[model samples]
Target: EEEEEEEEEEEEEEEEEEEEEEEEEEEEEEEEEEEEEEEEEEEEEEEEEGEEEEEEEEEEEEEEEEEEEEECLEYINFCYKLVISVCCERSVVVVPHKDTSGVTRHVMRGEKCWCCASQRHFRCHTTCHARSLQP
Candidate 1:
């Protein structure tokens, strides 16, 4: 009977140790799962930030393109206008543009003979030191 009691006690102790080990393993698994969840969340946040930056860059590019389009349109308008310049004695010609209530639509530098010899800004190439151009 004594031997049986000793064997039973040993068996009980072994079972308790096994239970403790199982509990430790479960706790370790829980910790690993939490760490994985945290890492996933961090990755997701990084992706979102990257996406936002890309969107902002795209918007800026679009704005620049719109500004470029406006400039091109202005150039096209200048090309289609009927411009005439008159100058005398190798002088620069200052031609007339839209006269908005005596406000003088086109403003430029150099003497206002403004015919031939006008600067590139004036966009005129006709010179009349000899005779007037036939438009």
Candidate 2:
């Protein structure tokens, strides 16, 4: 009877050890799952931040384009006024003349002249004269 009791006690101890090991494995698995979840959440937040930054950059680019368009319209109006003043009121000759400076002073046949010359008045005068001849 004593021997049987000793065997039973040994078996109980073995079972307890197995149960403890299983609990430890379950805890480890839970910890790993929690860590994976945290990592995923961090990645999602980063993606959202990147998207917001991209949106802001796009908005800024759009605003810059609008400002450039407005400036272009204003320049066109100024050029139109110059054409009217020199062609109609001044009645200057619509010919290209090169002055002391090497820069050519007239609009090309098919090309637009930005009036890039050292002398502003002469440049506007020639550009306006050329513009008058256009249909």
Candidate 3:
């Protein structure tokens, strides 16, 4: 009977050691899973931020294109009007004027000559001098 009691005690000790090892393995697995979940969340947030930045860049480009288109249209309209006036023999003159109020960059003055009517932004003094000189 003494020998039997000793064997039983030894078996109980072995079982307790195996249970402790299994508990340790389970704890390690839980920690690994938590780490993986946190990493995934971080990756998702980074992707979302990248997408937002791209969208903003695209919007800015589109707005710039729109502004360019409007400016081109305005320039075209001015050119068309100039052509009509020239064809009708209506003289147009462009004279440089200082902006007293910081508003207009240049102001027109006097009736435009035939040469000025044909040329765009024609300087009257230079062209007049060239044309009027004895050839």
Candidate 4:
């Protein structure tokens, strides 16, 4: 009878140890699942932030392009005005004038005097006279 009681006790102890081991394994699995979920959440947040930054960069680039286009339009308009005032009006001249210090200044002065007058002088004069109804 004593021997039978000793064997029973040993079986009970073994069963208890197995149950404890199973509970420990389940806890470890739950911890691993929680860690994986947290990692996934972090990755999603990072992706969203990166996308926002890219959108902002694209907006800035578009604004810069628009500003450059406006500047180019202004330059073209200025050139048109210069051509009209200098090439069409025949007001360009290379003359001598006295400056504020009584020094003689011989300067080629006009709206577009930087252009080659020798090549366009005849055409300009004819066009100007025709447009003005002059003889």
Candidate 5:
């Protein structure tokens, strides 16, 4: 009977050890899950920051294009007299002095004049008039 009690005690110890091991495994799995969630949150934040940066870059590009268009109108002399033909039928009057006034206000915020124009259009009014003669 004592021998049997010893064997039963040994088996109980083994079962206890197995239960402890299972609990340790469960704790480790919980820790791993927490770590994975943290990593995913970090990644999502990074992606959000990246998207914001891209949006800022796109806004900058759009502002630059708007600046270029405004400068084009500024440098062109007699811009008020310039009549732009839309598809060779209707004509749109380009009053640079009035239409470009708002754009100039924005450019003036950076204290820059309308000096940055396309290199191809070197001459002010003469170049456009010359181009109009071409077929």
Candidate 6:
């Protein structure tokens, strides 16, 4: 009877040890699963951040392009306005004066004045008569 009791106690101890080991293995598996989930979440967050940054960079580039286009248009309009100068005779268009000295047949920036023009053209007159053959 004493031998039988000792054998039964030894068998119970072995079963308890096996149960503990199984529980430990289950806990380890849970921890591994949790860690894997966290890593996956981190990867997703990184991808989202990268996409957002790219979108922001593209928006900034577009805005810069729009600003450049607007500036170019304004510059073109201003230059055109300067090119059409008002002559002295019939004053309609007003523009800044730039002297192109001794330039006949080609009027630049409005008036063909005394110093710059030939003898026939009056001050501020749009009409320019061709040079006479006589001296």
Better of 4 and 6 by lDDT: 4
lDDT of model 4 at position 38: 100
Q: Mind giving the per-residue lDDT tens digits that candidate 4 earns over 8-89?
A: 9999999999999999999999999999999999999999999999999999999999998786566445544554565455
Report the lDDT tens digits of candidate 6 across residue range 72-123.
5664455344333333334434433233343333333343443435543233
Best by lDDT: 2
Better of 3 and 6 by lDDT: 3
lDDT of 3 by residue, 1-135 (tens): 999999999999999999999999999999999999999999999999999999999999999999987865665455444444443463553333222343423323343433345443444333342332221
Better of 3 and 5 by TM-score: 5
Tell me the TM-score of each prediction against the true structure: 0.56, 0.64, 0.57, 0.64, 0.58, 0.63
Taking the tens digit of each residue's C-alpha lDDT, what string does model 2 give over 67-132?
987865665565566555555554542344333353536543323434343334443444444443
Q: Model 5: per-residue lDDT, tens digit, 22-135?
A: 999999999999999999999999999999999999999999999987766555533323423321233322323322323422111122224443333223332333232211
Name the lDDT value of residue 73 in candidate 3.
Answer: 62
Model 6 stretches with alpha carbons more than 4 Å out: 86-135
Cα-based lDDT at residue 46, candidate 4: 100
The root-mean-square deviation over C-alpha atoms between each candidate and the true structure, in angstroms, is: 9.3, 7.9, 9.2, 10.5, 11.3, 11.5
Name every residue pair that clashes in candidate 6. 88-124, 89-124
Residue pairs of candidate 5 with colliding backbone atoms? none
Q: lDDT at 5 for candidate 4? A: 96
Ranking of models by lDDT = 2, 4, 3, 1, 6, 5
Using TM-score as the measure, name the better of candidate 5 and candidate 6.
6
